[model samples]
Target: MCVEEQWLTPQGIVIGTLLGIVLHVRFSPDDQQVAVCAGNKIYMLSAKNEAILAELDGHLAPVTAAEFCTWEKSMLISVSEDRTFKARKL
Candidate 1:
């Protein structure tokens, strides 16, 4: 994905990939990082280069949704079909 500023110059900011089936993705309020969920795991990546910063795994079933906490930039919430919700700090 590329991050671009809406201005006269339409230069794109190229970012790498997480290399998997991405189920969901959300960006933090600061816009410096992003949370990605794939299969049963969640990963935090740099929004600038898409580098993997952290990986979290706990759910037994496939993940359904992933969201970032507005109040906490380092906190992420995820829900799975295993009938469980997880709160993790990235």
Candidate 2:
């Protein structure tokens, strides 16, 4: 979704809550990125800046879990309330 928005704390630390009500979060295999599941979509974010990089929309219900593929950092696996599981390429 490319939120391009940042949330700053009083101490000047930035925490990204852009995805809104994130149900799950997992680091990439290399720990260089993060995958977040919010609503029915999955958001790919930069680990360093928490910048949204891509949005994947395929689930019909709220996503319940998300994890990066162990062998492929660009591949993400997700489960949803829709009773389905899916994989997306980042």
User: Each prediction's TM-score against the native?
Assistant: 0.75, 0.78
Tens-place lDDT digits, model 1, residues 17-90: 54478778887888888777788887778898848888789999777788888788778899988999998877
At residue 1, what lDDT does model 1 achieve? 38
**Stretches of model 2 off by over 4 angstroms after superposition:** 1-15
- Candidate models: Cα lDDT each: 0.79, 0.80
lDDT value, candidate 1, whole model: 0.79
Query: How many clashes in each structure?
Result: 0, 0
Name the runs in model 1 displaced over 4 angstroms: 1-18
Top lDDT: which candidate number? 2
Please report the TM-score between candidate 2 and the true structure: 0.78
